[model samples]
Target: MAAKRGGAPANKIISDNRKARFNFAIEDTLEVGIELKGTEVKALRSGKANIGESYAAEHKGEIWIYNVYIPEYLQGNRNNHEPRRPRKLLLHKREIGKLALAVQKDGKTIVPLKLYFNDKGFAKLEIALAKGKKLHDKRETEKQRDWNREKSRLMKNLG
Candidate 1:
């Protein structure tokens, strides 16, 4: 583990990527470390992070997160990292191998599920191996969700 810092542990969520869950079928999740600048880290500490529009892409065999917006730190001037610059995700070799296999075998993609802080105050990303859901699949999921809601309503009324 990296050197622990701050008073609070990190696994606490800073922002969620709800669209990923709705748009894809998540098969597996992996936690990876984010390489962030000092200002970005500060923004994350203050929970000013957004992962909803973020996605991960493999470039030259390394995974980089894209569209993750970390707002400029209030006090930092001229040195703040670009809010949506691609950030590398650090994962173990074996884990990367598994993810690569899954991507190749299933035509799945690794998507960022959320961004959070870990127990040691390090920024962490939850990435999911996911298959994109088709339009009909999305409709079916919504229908099922609605049916479940209605079923619970009827059950509550009867009971």
Candidate 2:
């Protein structure tokens, strides 16, 4: 596991999509649970899952996460799971309705920000209702990040 310097809670995290913040203007976030298979859980425990290219979509009045890669567990000789299978995301009925409405009418996206296990060891997803950022907006965000870094350095030296 990587050092928990300034990111998520070190123990529970499986994988984090750090670039989601840079690519989207997140308007709201929700903690949703994930349904995984036996081998998938083992893969996650080994910290070999990738949610970077994964996204949540509504299907048959339910939400599912697509394109997430949970690599097959090596020890599973023949019963290993698929690497890029669509997984179900557990959410409240109202929340799913709201997200579907937003995507249908408001042009918003359901992006997965991070993947981790919660306090009770259940796999959870940090999803966000977001709008895609424009090129100029991305440039502005980059500038702000650089300025923040410089300001922090100056403050550290002075104090």
Candidate 3:
């Protein structure tokens, strides 16, 4: 999703976890705000972060993102944030409860898809409820992707 600001769409992407789509089947998604420290936000603004190996979980009734690597800000000397800290995710109580219960009952895992700044300049995260893809399913996805690429090339040649 995107928001408009000053008559322009404001969705400046910071980091994207492309690996998530290849490894899991995303069933549901939500756009959530992220809570970040000063240094963490500075580091992210510089685009020096990775969320490819990150996942979210509930702890003590709150949701947190784990394993996301936002490197220390170069200008924030002596007061930099941890690079691999488990950051808190800002979500509503009802949504948090539902996501927690979904994980418990349906075994779906919460994965971060993309990180971006919204129109109001607030950091946001796109999270998805996904199930792991089996080996065969992964292989099939690869095969289908390859076929589509080849088909597009052939069509272009014919045209």
Candidate 4:
């Protein structure tokens, strides 16, 4: 059954990293821009990108997104870029420096949250600074989530 709340249908999300939510505790999140070629941009507009296997790394003090696959455009003539190319993320110098420091000192990693288009029709990425969870932590989180789901279901039925 489709779940709706507040007299509105749920948001239609294109894709999500279900594993990320199950495996990590996200500490902070930031929205960043991706530098892409024309062909890549067109492919993204068609909702043809996946960041599930992607990670962000600091190189020479700049943040670059790696392993995010954007499939080739079928109608491209000859300018298609590689599928797994590393793309530079646009951020302020201070933000880059802070990310580098947090990564190096705290051992936290940046994981891609989701890739989606904003209301302005531009492709944007939501990235998160996450601390990896241990095995027991994941189990506990799963238990809590299941309990919450049951509680909500009971409340709806009773009310």
| Collision count of model 2 | 0
Candidate 3: where are CA atoms >4 Å away?
A: 1-9, 157-159
Residue pairs in clash, model 2: none
Report, for every candidate in turn, its global Cα lDDT versus the true structure.
0.87, 0.91, 0.92, 0.83
Instruction: Please give, for residues 1-159, the per-residue lDDT of candidate 1 as tens digits.
Output: 898566775478999989888999998998899888888888888887888877887777788888888998888999777888999989887787888777888799889988888777778888999999999999999999999999999999999
TM-score of model 4 (CA atoms): 0.86
Ranking by lDDT: 3, 2, 1, 4
| Model 2 worst lDDT run, 10 consecutive residues | 2-11
Q: Which lDDT value does model 3 have at 3?
A: 50
Per-residue lDDT over 1-159 for candidate 2, one digit per residue giving the tens place of the 0 to 100 score: 975465445448878998999999999999998888999998898888889999999999999999999988989979789999899999999999999999999999999988888766788899999999999999999999999999999999999
For candidate 1, the per-residue lDDT at 53 reads: 78
TM-score of each: 0.88, 0.88, 0.88, 0.86
- Give candidate 2 misplaced runs (Cα > 4 Å): 1-11, 157-159
Question: What are the C-alpha RMSDs, in order, of all predicted structures?
Answer: 3.8, 5.2, 3.2, 5.9
